[model samples]
Target: MRYDLKVPFAEKDQAKKLGARWDAARKRWYIDEGLDPADFARWQPAPHDASSAAVSAPASRRAAPAGSEGTVQVGSRFVELPRMCDCLPWEDCDACRLQAWPK
Candidate 1:
């Protein structure tokens, strides 16, 4: 399975250097199979089955409150909550576009 990395905007260039590729339709970056996920641990998406009700919630309903941290299950492992860029109103900034911002 392909895993999407939660790459921050500031690190886009670095990620590209490390071989991550962007999926324009999904607007996320993912490491190709056979690459060591550990190298891109920070960007790994939390594991959640697509069919699960929790993950199926509407975007606004699933958002984490401002300044609050939460956990997401990732392939049987849990990782720190993903952080979003503070630049609100994103303004088409590259970093903001790369983030999965709270609705």
Candidate 2:
């Protein structure tokens, strides 16, 4: 399923950098199958109904989609979220690891 985002115009570039695609006809951004929705949490649409509560939950609190096998595509690459810190894909892995394991 294609998940649409509520991205503002000013943040379009950031959204694009995070792997969201522009739907010119709809004038919105979206992520296709295999791309983890958690990666675009900041711009996810507000839930309108009860079941949608899951959609608005924080990424860490949500489980991976069925059949994902623990990885998701971000831009042109595949990343292992379980191996790296839970930072957004665009964030520096080294920096995120340091923050996640400060000594």
Compare the candidates by TM-score and give the number of the best one.
2
Query: In model 2, what is the error at residue 103, expressed in angstroms?
Result: 97
* Candidate 2 worst ten-residue window by lDDT: 49-58
* Candidate 1 per-residue lDDT over residues 14-96, each given as its tens digit: 88988898888767777777788788877666667342221244687787877666754367565566545666563666776
Q: At residue 41, what lDDT does model 1 achieve?
A: 77
Could you tell me which residue pairs clash in candidate 1? 6-43, 47-73, 47-74
Off by over 4 Å in 2: 49-103
For each candidate in the order shown, give its overall lDDT on alpha carbons: 0.69, 0.76
- Candidate 2 global lDDT: 0.76
Candidate 1 residue 92 Cα shift, in angstroms, is 43
- In terms of lDDT, the best-performing candidate is 2
